[model samples]
Every structure is written in C-alpha cells, then in structure tokens.
Target: MNQDLIQTFIEETEENLQVVEESLLDLEQAPADQELIDLVFRAMHSIKGGAGLVGFEEIGELAHYLENILEEIRQAANPKLPDDIFNLLFAGIDLIRQMIEDNDLTAKSVGRELTELKKAIKHYQLVTQEGSSDEQTIQQQTGQKYYKINLKFRETIFETGTDPLMLVLELEEVGTILASYLNREQVDDLFHLNPHLLLMNWTIFLESEQSLDKIEDIFIFVKEDNQIVIEEISEELEQWFSGGEETEKLLRKEEFISNVDLDQVLAKQEQIGESLFLQSKTTKEETGQADKQVRNLHKQKRTETIRVATDKLEGILNDIAELLIAQSRVKELATGIVGLDRSLQSEIVNSFQEVDKLIRRVQEEVMSASMIPIGDTFTRLKRMVRDIAAEKEKDVKLVISGEDTELDRKIIEQLADPLKHLVRNAVDHGVERPEQREKLGKPPTGTIELDAYHQEGSIIIEIVDDGRGIDKEAVLAKAKEKGMIEQESQLDDSEIYNLLFKPGFSTAQEVTDISGRGVGLDVVMSNIKDIRGNVEVFSEKNQGTKIKIKLPLTLAIIDGMIVRVGGERVVIPLNSIVEFIDASKQQIKQVEGKGLIVSIREQYIPCMALNELLQLEGSFNNLKEEPTGVLIILKDDQKQIAVQIDEVIGQEQVVIKNVKENMGQAEGIAGATILGDGNVALILDVPTLFKLAKRLKVG
Candidate 1:
C-alpha cells in the first residue's frame, strides 16, 4: 500500500520482464548453453529480490522456484529445456508488465500462472537433478545455510533521513559476518540524487551463542521503527557449525595477542612506505606523472551508481543558455559604444567566442551522457530470436553489428517495441524453415542480420532475413481483394509491397496462432512513424527481405524555422523544410479548380495558408505583397505541400514540450517552445497539416 514501494515494484517488475524477454530469447537459441541458464537464473534471482521488497510473498515464492530451476539447469548443463517452460516464463513476464502498468495483472492471475509454472519447473528440475551429480552438488551447497537472518532496514529508515551506510557498518560489529550482498539493482539513473533509500538486504551467518532477541538488542536505539528480522535456518547453521569445528578446537580462553617486536615492525613498515613513495616521485619526475591511482578496495563501500536525470541537465543547459545570452548582450552594447578601444573590443570578442564554444561543448556532453548503447537492447533480443526461430522450425541466427551505437535513453525505450516487432516478424514470417531451405539448395540455417549504424544524423536499424522474399504479386492480389488498392491503380512493385502496411492487410494462406492476422506490420509502421522514422522494405524473388527503419537521433530539441501566415506565426521543423523560395507572380498558377500551386524546378508545390489550418485570420488580397511572400516547401514522399507564410524568421534550436498527455487539445500543433523573447511558439504538425490541406482543397 506504500506508494514508494509500489513504484519500486513497478520498476523492478519492468526489469524482470526485460530479463524474461532476454532469457527466453537465449533459451530459444542455445537451449542447452550453460551461460543462458545463468542468464535466466539471474533474472529470476532479481525478481525474487524485488518481490520480497514489496511484501509480495506469492510472487517471491514463485520467483524462488524459477531461480531454482535456472540454477539447476546451469549446474547440470541441462541441454534439453522444455518449450512449455519458456512459454510460461514469457506469460509470467507479460503478466508482470500488465500488473505494473495498469495494476490489473491481478494476484489471482499471477498466482495461477506462477503456480502452473512452478509445478512444471519443479517436475523438470526433479527429473534433471535425479540423474545429474553436478546438480546435486549445487543443491547441497545452496541448501547448507540453515539460519537465514534477513535484517531489512525499516522503510522509514531512509526517509526519516537515517544514514543507511552507518546502520550496515554498525551491524558488522555485532558478529563475524560470513557474507553480504547489496541489492543495487533498483538504482536507476536519476538526477538530484538523494541517497535516502535503503536498497541493501543482509544475509549473514553470524558466529554467536545468542538468542534472536539478544541479536536484535544491537538495534535498540532505533529498533522501535527499524526492521530486525531473524530466522533460524537450522540446516544451514549445522553446516556452518560443522565447517568451523577445527577452529573451535584452536580457540583458547586467554587474552593473548600475537606480540611482535614494534621497533623492527615499524622499521619494515617505514622501509615499505619509503620505497613506494620513492618509486612514485622518481616515476613522476623522470617520466610524466605517476602512472598509478590510489586503489583501496577494502574501504570502497559498495554504493549504487547515480546518474543525473535529463530534466536536471536540461535546467543546467537552460542556465548556460541564459548566461550565453547575457554575454551576447554585453558584446552587442560594447560594439555600440561611442569611444570603445579597438584592441579592448577585439579581446572581448575573442573571449566571448571562447566562452560560447566551451558552454556549447558542455551542453552537448551533458546531453550525450544520457545516451545508453543500443547493444544492451540487442543482447536481450538474442534470446527472443532463439525461441521464435525454434517454434517456427527455422534455423535462424541473429548476427548483430554496431551495438555500441548510443541513443537517448527515451529513444531507446521507444525503440524497443518496434525493434522487437520487426525481429519477430522476420523470424515468424521471413525466415524459412530448415527443411524447406535445404530443399532449395540453401544453407540449413538462415541468417537474420540485425545491423545498426549512424547515417545523416540518424540511426538505421535493419532486420534482413535470408529466406523467401516477399511475394509482390501475392501482396497486390491481397490488396485488391481487401479493396486497399483501386482496381485501376498504377502502383509499382515497391508500392504494392507497401500495401502490407495498410491496416488489416494479410496475405497468409494459412493462419497461425502467432501472427497471421497481420496486426504486426501495421503496428511496426505506425511506431516507426510515431518517432518520425521511416521503414522501407526490399525483397528479391528468391534472395530475402530487408526492412530498414531510420530514426532521428533525438527528439528533445530541434532546429525549426518560424514563419508567419495570416498574421500568425507557426514553427516548421528545419529538417522537414526541403526548400524555401519567393513565390513569383508569373511562376504561380492556379491548379485548375484546386488550390494554388507553384512550379519549382518542374515540381508542383501545393500551397496552404498557415492561418487557415489553425483557423487564425489573415489577409493576402494584394498579389504585390504576396509576390514577396515565402513558400516553405515540405516533402515526405506521401505529400509535397508548401505552407504560404508572410516571412521566414530563420532557424533556431527549439526544445520540444509535448502538450501533456490526456490533457488539452494539441490538434494542429506538434508541441510548443519559448522564443528568445520568451514568447510561446507553437510547433506546427506537418503531417497533420498536410493531410488537412488535401482535405480542404478537395472540399
């Protein structure tokens, strides 16, 4: 019921789902690989840890069972993992995601699904462990712990502003702690970091002849509010006691310490310190600086890594921008001075430029720091490709390249689902089954190349499959049957191929349980377009199919041209502004009964009034005033419509702010930004406006 823990549960569940996705993908490809077994185990291990945090006992128990199966498989090197297990894991992951997102993945659904999976995994583990010695050894080693003293710090222990590190260090003095691991998995990259959360849970086998209350007495100062959990794992305690029997015999009832000659020991210590210091000084003086760092791993307290959030960075950049503006104003006034010296003015100019360059670099780096490599995502997909390929009876291998390519973290999150859809489509539809491909004289296994690289200030991800290429003829027939294409359509092969993206378009001869209803491709196209990306398909008769998706590097800020039409200003994305020209009276011609069109280099540029789109009033009665009016041309292949505006105010970097979700209408506007004068400018939605212009002209 605690909101903080609830939020943590959601975040942790998301990470678990990611693990499930990756693990399943791996299990599909290398079902018997020990590394994959470990991957799956780690996923379950983290899930169990998270479930314990929120007091979700059922979820925690289920995760423990999953972890057991994974660890068993890893130790035994089990080669034949069942399909049912992977399916159940996927289902669990989906259920968890739903539960977190909507709070609708009910406990009943979770318990039922988990119960089913637990039963299956237990049976499988029993079978696998019965014949495997390695599995038995692992089980015995893990089972040796009899007492599990789980000392969880109170939830308010953090928010009450108690120093968690002090508490952990304090616990160390209570007994001889055997082992400790910090649960740092929940720490994400966020700005304005306040380390007020207790994320560490201790599991220690203390050497003591004391009761649970005696142990709990150590936390007496804050015990009223803090958590002190003590569970006696008898079997584990027996193993620990048995292991230390020899040490007990060595123990003596004497206050005796290992006495040493202090003078001799001090001399040796001095000698060692002098040698190290001399080595450092000599190296630094002779070469460059000392080629070493002071590394003290013992005192290096394990703490979660913290990163600044994007909003904090944005605020910092904004301050820097204001500083730059002040600098610009100073430069402007200094130039306008009546008696300013030439040399002084030049010095100030150079200094201003230097400041400008440094500030810009810092801003860019602050932005770049938020970029996480795409490889992290691709690595997860390795498992997905594995399982899907198996289910389809296809021998498919996913070879990824340019994984180190980094994108904004926001971009990465949005990129995941679309990339998944593309890859799955490739596996389920494009990759031919092993037997079918061998019969065609092709290699038994198909290669699905997942490649990403930077080009034209954007990143391109491609899903290329070496199997039967898409049948253009079949696609055209399906389109005709679906009435998606007019009977008299003059569409080419590429155009026909694009018809696959039309909603509810499917040409599958037989429907499968997975994806034959053709819901995926349309979604892929829509998602790509949502991020202002484009997806193109290329297919040969018998070679293969390649679906390439190109996305902009970042969506936070954009260079846009502000233009006025009907006496109101609208901002156009600079990237989409292909060309701008002064509309000449002679060059302009009316398109029959349609709207105005201008001939520019043998291309007809359709024109729309900016004010009319947003319903703002303006006049263009005089052709002489309109002669100098700018025609801002935009093109997306789907349309080449130009908005006629009074004047182009040039380009400036504009930070995009979404009209807050589920709030007000942002119908004609993409987003809004503040101008240099602090005036709010609406970013025009080009695609929406383009569609609107066509509709109005036809009317």
Candidate 2:
C-alpha cells in the first residue's frame, strides 16, 4: 500500500472517530434520536471499510462488530440504547482510537482488551437480536428485494487503495449474495499486463432487506468515476443461486455475467495474482518510485481540498512575517536616498505602499486559515466531564455556548490540556454533590458552563460552575501555612483566590486521582501565560467560581503602539490601550497607601512610570517630577492603569519574536519585535505591568 494512502486513511479515520465520539455523547442525551444513531452507524461503517482497504485487520474487525451493534440499536423499535450498551460503545471507540495510534493491536494488554470487548459485543448482538424473529416475519411480509449491482471500476482505482473485492465483501455483510460473476474481458496476458490497473468487473445478485439508498452508499467513494448501477431484479432471478447449467444460462441471458469460462478466468487471475508478483519482480526502490508517481497523480486529481501539515502553514506564516519586516526595511531605506528624483521617490513610495498592502492582505488570509472554531475542543470536554462526574458519583452537567468563536489553531492545540485541567477541576473541586446541593437550596444537578467570545480584539473563555465556590479564608490560611504568603499579609478577594494557582497549593482534605495533588491549576496558569494569555478567578461563598482567560487573537503578529520611554523604545499592544492623556504635575498625585494616581476625567487610576516599571535608564526618577510626559491608559478587565512615556512614535503592525528563550522571562515584557530601523523593541505586557504597579508603593 502507498504511504500517502495510509496517512490519508489515518487522518480521515481519526476525524470520523471524533465525530463518532461526539455523536455518542449527544445520543446519551437524546437516546431516541434517529439522526444521531445513523450518524454513528455511518461513521463506523466508513471506518470499517477504510480499515479493510488499508489491511488493518484488527481495526476492521473491531469496527465491523461495533457497526453491527449500532445497526441493532438503529433498527430497534425504540432506539434508546441502554446505559451498559453506551458504555460498551464508548469503550469500543477508545480501543479503536488506541489501535489507530499504535497502528496495530498486537500488544498483550490491547489484545486481551480487544478479545474481551468482542465477546461483550457478541453477547449484546445476541441480546439485541432476540427480536430477529419479528424482523424476519416483517421481511417475509414485505418480500426481500434482489439488487443486480454492476461495478465497472476505473483502471486507476488501485491507485486509490480501494480493493474491489472489499466492496463485494461489504455487500455480503449487509445481505446474502445469491449469485456473483467476474468479467475479465479487459485482462491481458500476465506478461503484458500492467499490475497497477484494475481490469476486472463484478456482477453481484444481492438479496437484501435494505433500501436502494443504502446500497448505493457502498459505492460512494468510487461512484463518481466508476460505473456503478444498482437496480431491483425480478424475484425469479433469486433462484439462480442453485448454481447449475440453467443458472449460468439465465445469468448470461440477463447480460449480468459474461460468457467467459469461470475456471479459465480464475486460473488467469490467480496466475497474474495481486501485486505480490510485481513486488517480488521489482526492486524496493523502483516500487517506491512508482508508488510515489501514482500518489502524486492521484493527488492532482483531487482539487477540491488538500490537507497541509500545520507546521508547513506555520512556516509560511513565518516567511511572510520576515517579508513584512524586509518591506519595512526597504521603505525605511527608500527614505534615505539623498539624490533621488522627486518623481522616482514618489513612485518608489507608492510601490512600497502597494506591496505593503498586498503583504498585509496575505498575512490576514494566512492568519484566517490558521484559525479554527473552538467548538471541537468544547465538544471533547463533554466526555471528560461525564467520566469524572460518574467516577466521583456527582451529577454535573456541562453547558457550552459561543462555540463558534475562532482562535489560532496553534493556540487551540495548546489550550486542550489546560482546558481539560480546568474542566476536571470544576467537576472535582468546584461542583458539590447532589445531596449537598439540594440542602443548599440549589438544583440537584450542578452546571458547569464553558463560554467563549470576542472582546477588545481578544478571545475570552470562561469556565463558570454554579457549585460550592472557593473558600477565601481557607485559601489564605493555606497560603500562609505553606509560606506562599506572609501570615500578616492583607490581600483582597481576587488576590486570595489567585493563591490557588501557587505550586503545591491545595485545600482538599485528601488527594484523589483527579486533582488535590496541588498540580492542576498551576499548570493551567503556566500554559495560559506561555501563550501570552492571562487567567483570573472570581468566586462567591455559595454562588460559584468563574475562571476567565484572556488570549490574543494570534501569536504571530499584532498591532502595536510604539512609544519611547526615556532611551528605550517599546511596543504596547494597541488593543490594551484605552486612550492617551497629557497630565501636569498637579494632575498626578500620590495617594496614602496606593501608588501614583493620575487624574483623568474625574477618574483616579493608578499610574506607573514606564521607565520605572521597566527599570530603563534616562527616565524620570518620579512621575511627579516629569508629570509633563504623556500617559497611556491601559485597561484589563475592570482594572485600569496609566503608564507615563516620554513620547508616542505612532502605531504599526509588528511580528512578535520570542525573546524569553534567549533572555529568559522578563517582568513586564511579553516579547520583542524588530523595528524598521534594524533595532529591536520590547513588547509590553499590559496585564503584568498592572500587577507590578500594584506592588510598587511610591510616595
């Protein structure tokens, strides 16, 4: 088999399995939903066929039995599968996923699990098929219809890695094969034939109680290029299965089977064999080269869509970022030509401007391409919540909204673990048990809501649970006992809640497998911050706890406001700045216990000198001494702050480069970007700066 075909099969199988898992979850909620049942059945059917075509016998066998169980549930008078059945189905999905990951199911433990699952499935089949008598009575009443299927596949069908015999075998699984014939008229002598070309056609008389739609779906992948005709035949033709001279005569008379000698054709096919002989005749390298050529040709024919690796897309984005920086440099150099003509300079400026616009458009499109809806990630969390709730013997329901909110694919990938941790924590630590909830005058079933929406050019995701909220005093006491904070430290509710993120910090009385090892939240905080996002917690004693995370739209580039603070040049994210204000010495005043405050429109917001926050030289020692400088008001959530800068150097889009790897983590800097003048400017992290300002007490 071709490597490309194997990879494509794996990718497609994984996607289909995800769909199956999601639909299975939905089916539990609406057990009698016909659409969901059929959705699952079809996905498993596709997986089974693909697995067989790829020669993954274990996957094919497992999917086949699972598909049989789904079919039983699908055809039942009441399509409500039992809880035990759903559990078995979910377990089967997990095994299939494991098989796909390992590419084989030969491991000792996996093989044992597979054997046990198959036995359980077989038991369910027998239990479900107790109604087969009624089904047979109904089929007798309606009379079975026979389908005459003629399959004339394209010569290049082999390149697609589809075995015509697999289609026949699948048909047999759905119903009884009354009669079958192979047409080998296109086959040449073994020495002269091309091994890659499919030359035979099949004529199958199938007696089935299935619909025409179901029969046609078997040929879905090949129907476009191949000649697949399915029509109901006379009931009398069913008698041709007796297999005698008269049966062959009848089949030939109907033009369903050619007059070729069956034995001779079988002998010729056996002589030519499958690709085994070809593989033995050619060197490994030659066969690989041929397979590559065939795969490339097949890829060219598939123009509707193609999957590109995510790393390749990332590489393209990075190259485009470099091009933008080069364009900026070119524009800067164009301004320095002392003896250039005015007309030439104007044309050069316009050309550069046009290129800049095109590059920006390309960047936007690439960024858009890299974004996917967060719904898939949200859907995956449903199983997590269900399993954990079941294990803890709690009744918890997860409500998800704003699933269509899109984020960068890279960010979404990195978000899965953190989101899983948070959701698990919500189920484990946040939500109270059913009895406890009822005693508190709350609903028996607790709810955890996962929401995402866009605000201020950023994505905000909230995991809110209406359960037992965080105990502020307990958290504070734990912090003091662990020496994470001073015993005399006076902290606000938010600060106390933030203590949960400290490493090895837990308020649980005992540890469990889910959480309570003091491991989850700190990892969540670290992962979120690695993507330059911020997480905050809000809780009320009996109300609930909400963990809100703010993330940038993309990690590659951002619109930044360039500012000069003393001798250092910095870029503040444009989305973080509220407005600019010019304040005099009197407008800036020192509060009793707070840092410097700037009065703007009757609102006194905490003010920090940019130079002091970043500890840059050549900056004013105090904002009161140089209150003449401009102040950029930055807002995060409900908190607002003012940072004093010497001057604003206008705004520009900059490509963010990670400086942490080279310089290690800095206090207030997110990353660094290269300016047009071949100089690097540090990108300011507004949220971190806010935290730093709160700790700085200036008089």
Candidate 3:
C-alpha cells in the first residue's frame, strides 16, 4: 500500500473513531435517533472504504459487517436496538481499528472472526425477518470499489457562482442515476420556510467509457471547499443494493403494520370528506396541505467529517520548517563570497524570495488543517457533568453553546483533560446540593455552561457554573492554614481567587476521586501557560464561578523582540514586553535584596537584568559608573523584569522550534528559530524566567 494513502486512512479513521465515541455516548440516550446511528454506521463505512483502498482487506470486511447491522437499525423506524448490539458494534469498531493498526498481522489473525461476524448478522436477520426486520442484509462485497459522495456545503460555496445543483445535474449526464434519494424533506411551509438550501443525494451508477478522472473533473472546482467524496465502493454493489429487495418486498405487505411502508398508511393518516365529522373542506386545498406537511420532513443529512492527521500535517510543517531553515542556509552561503559573484547572489536572493513565498503558502494551509471546532472538547463534558450531578443526587444541567467556534487542534486536544477536570470540580465542589440550594432560595438544578468564541486572534473558552460561589474568607483561611499566605496579607479579590490554583491546595473539606487531588488546577494553569495562554478565575460569594482561558490562534510563527545576550542572539515574545528604557546606575535601586527598581519617568519599575539571572559568560552586569547594556522592560502581574542586553536587536516574526528534551527546558530559552542570517535565535521564556528570578531573589 502507498504510504500517503495509508497515512490519510489513519488520519480519517481516527476522526471517525472520535465521532463514533461521541455518537456511542449519544446512542445510550436515543438509540433510535437515525442521525446518531448513521454517524456510527458511516464511521465503519469509511473505515471499510479506506481500508480496502489501502489493501487492508480483512479489516475492511469486518467494518463492512459492522456497518450492515447499524445500517439496518438506521433505516428503520423505532429500531429494536439493544445496548448489546452497540456493544458488539463498539467491539467491531475496536477490532477493525486493531486490525488496521496491526497492518503486519503479527499476532493472532481476526480473519476467521470477521467471517463469523458476517455470517452471524446475516443468519440473524434472515431468522428474524418474519415479524420485524431492520434490513435484508446488504450483500456488499469487500472487493468492489465505488464512489459514495455527499455534498451539503456552507453558503459561501454558492457565492462562488457555482450551482451545486447544476453540478449534480451534470453528473447525471455522465453516469446512470443509481440509488438517487432527494431529502426534499426540509422543504417546508412556503410562507415561512427556506428554499435556497438544496437537500438531496443522487448516487450515480457511473459506467462511463471516460475514466474516473473525467467523473472527478466535474467536481474539481468546488471539491476542496465542499463535502465531496470520490471513492471506490465494492465490485459487487448491485448484489449489495439488491440484497435488501427481499426485505423490502417482505415489508411491502406483511411487515407494513407500523412503518414507512404500511398498507393504507397514507389512508389511515389521510382525513377525507370534511373529516366526516368537521366540515367538507377536503379538496385541492387538502392535497396541498398534505404536500406541505411532508415537505418539512427533510432532516439534515450528515457527511463524515474529516481532517488531515496532525502528525501528517506536522510532518509537512516540519518540512516547511526545514525548508525555511534551508532557505536561510542558502542566503547565508550567498553572502559576499570571495569569488565576488554579485549577479549570482542577486539570482540566488530572487530564488530564495520565491521559495519563501511558496513555503509560507504551504505552511498556512498546514496550519489551517490543524484547526478544529472547540465544541468537541465541550461536548465530552456534558456526560461528565450529568454523571456527577446524578451521583451527588443534584440536578445540574450542562448548557453548551458556541461549539462551532474553532481553535487550533493542538489547543483543543490539550484542553480536553483540563476542561474535564475543571467541569468535574465545578460540579463536585462548586454546585450546591439540592437541599442546600432550596434553603438558599436557589433553583435545585444548577447550570454548568461551556462556551467558546473567537476574538481578536485568540480562542476564548469559558466554563461557568451557577453554584454556591467560592467564599473568599474560606479560601483565605485555607490558604493561611497551608502557610500559603501571611497573617495580614492584603490581597485583592482576583489574587485571593487565584490562590486556588496553588500547588497542593484545595478548599474541598474532604477528598474524593474527583477534585481533591489538588493537582488539577495547577496542571491546568501550567499547560495553558505553556501554550502561551492565560487562565483567569472569576467568582462571587453566591452567584457562580467561571474560568476563562484565552489561547492564541497559532503557535507556528510569532513576532518576537530580539536581543543579544552573551553575544548569542535571543528572541523574547513580543506580547510580554511592557516597555524598554535606558537607565543610569544611580537610577537603579535594589529592593529586599531581590530585584532592582529604577524610577524611570517617575514610577518605580522592578527589573531583573538578563545577564545577572542568565549568568551568561562575559561581564556586562558589573557596571560601576553608568548603565552599560540596554534595558528591555518585561513585566507580568508577579513583578517587573528588565533583561539588560548587549544590544537592542529589534523585532521580527520568528518561526519557533522547540528546545530538545535531552538538553531539558532551557533556562531562558522558550524555543529556537532561524533568523534571516540562518543563525538560530533562542526565544526567551520571559514569564517563567521572570517568575523564577523573583523566587530566586526572594529565596
């Protein structure tokens, strides 16, 4: 199998598995929800499709069998679904995943079990077809290949002046219309309904002399922007499609008692001749009314969501990073050579410029591939809260909105565990019990809401719970007991609340498996900070608690203020620099033997000189008469820090590369990136370094 195709299959399968997990959770609530069933079914469908494409036949066959059972349930009304069915289904999903993973089939083979599963589902369906049946066993062979396409696009696709309808209609011109089903269900009451969004699927049984290339060309323009799948189903699709005919025919007469094909099902529903009890208003008007009623039945058809794998995209990003590095190397080599080749340098520079533009374009697309809706993390919390609320015997409703808001995939993944722990804590520690809430004149049911929205180049995720708010006095007492605070420490409300994230500190009177470990918030804070994010807590005496986390949209390229320390170039994140100043030695004043504060332009600003803290070799800090190095004033809420440097090297948008693990976290270096001269500039971890310096001076 081709590596690229296999990689794509892996990426898509993982996404499908994520959706399957989510749908499985939902299935516990509404097993008959066709959309949920379809979601699980299509996940298998995709696994089967992709596996076959990548020559993983045994895995494809397993997934195909699993999909058959779900398809049976999905197509039925009030499906006789048991949890055992999905248990088996989940097992099937797991097995197929295992098979794909074990591509080499090193251990025990699942080929025999897969064969047994297919026969079992068929035999059961055949055995149970007498009274009630979900499907007639879709006889899809794993060997066949066919394209199954779905296209329900965002409105922007139409603004491109492309008619998706016309495109589909043109597709009809190229192939035999096979399994065409129009979801005209959404066409509703004309007076108040929307007609612009076309809802239909016309599966063409394409048998063209022209190659699949021609069939694919019809969709080339909008394919990338729309939900379009060009794939190969099975070789024996006719057999598969017709396998349900026996089931369909059986249901046509005998099994028509309670479903879509019931005898006089329309007559039983239709009221004729003035209802024979109301009035004689049954006429063309009645026919129109019946049509109107059926129109709005068009439910939203879902497409299998996909994303390129992060490691795959990361591979590409690494390549681009390498490309930029190589480009820098090229420019480095072209610099003023002894051969005196001005024309050659000029051409090389031009080539480097062109390559840079192409590299940036590819890098941007790869970054976009890494973006995902923040809602995925938000959805997982609903179940957690529900279960927690139930355990405590309290009513807590989780209201999640803004789920469609997107964030960098890395941030979203990193956020899940933290958010889960937070929500769990909110319910366990924050929400009041039912009796306590009733006494306080509060509603018995507390509401925990997870909201996300994009603002000004960052994604803001907020977890707000309406519960008995954090008591500042209580927190302060706890802080005092732990010796985390002074006897007369005067702190503002924000500072008091921020103390909850202190290591090994919690207000919970008793420890449970949930919130009492005291490691949750500290971990959350550290993780968020690591991603260049800020986390803040908000609470009142009785209203609620809300934790807001703001994270930047991307981690690739960032603007950094450059400075030279130890004659070695270092870059500081531009966001952290409060101000810069040139000061005299008499202007610098030491405080508590910790950091020096200088009154520049009236107010005293504390500073930690980089040379002193970094202890870089060379002597720039021992200034006797005047301030020798430049002061780049860095400040956070904790204290102010000025990294005195050899020179102010200005700023640039530097692409960051992570510090190697073996060398450990660099003392001041956040990451390393290539400068225009091809030299690697270390980016300073100003926040951590500043805090570390504060602790050192205090110690």
Clashes within 3 Å, all models in order: 13, 0, 10
Q: How much lDDT does candidate 1 score? A: 0.62
lDDT of 2 by residue, 1-699 (tens): 878888888998999999999999999999866667767877898898988877788888889888877866654545556677788989998998887797763334599899999999888667655754443211111345567798888889876667888888889866887557777777899899999998887887676766554577677667768989987654444234434454545555644356656544334323322312222111112211222222123322555666788888899999988987887787678877724656578788688778878888999998888899999999999999999999998999899999999999989998999999999999998999999999999998999999999998999999999989999999999899999998899998878988988888899898999988877788888888888888888998888999999999999999999999888889999989999887554477878787688777788888878888788887474676657678888988778988888899988889999887897767778899998899999999888777777767532
lDDT of predicted model 2: 0.79
lDDT of all predictions, in order shown?
0.62, 0.79, 0.65
Q: Which tens-of-lDDT digit does each residue in 496-611 have in candidate 1? A: 77788888888776788667877877877766665656777899866899987777676566667878676566778776678777765426666676777677788777766566
TM-score of 2: 0.85
Winner by TM-score between candidate 3 and candidate 1: 1
lDDT of 3 at 406: 76
- TM-score for each of the candidates: 0.59, 0.85, 0.57
The candidate, 1 or 3, that scores higher on lDDT is: 3
Best-to-worst TM-score order: 2, 1, 3
**lDDT, candidate 2, at 57:** 84
In model 3, the clashing pairs are 144-233, 144-234, 144-235, 145-233, 145-234, 146-232, 146-233, 185-298, 186-298, 274-279
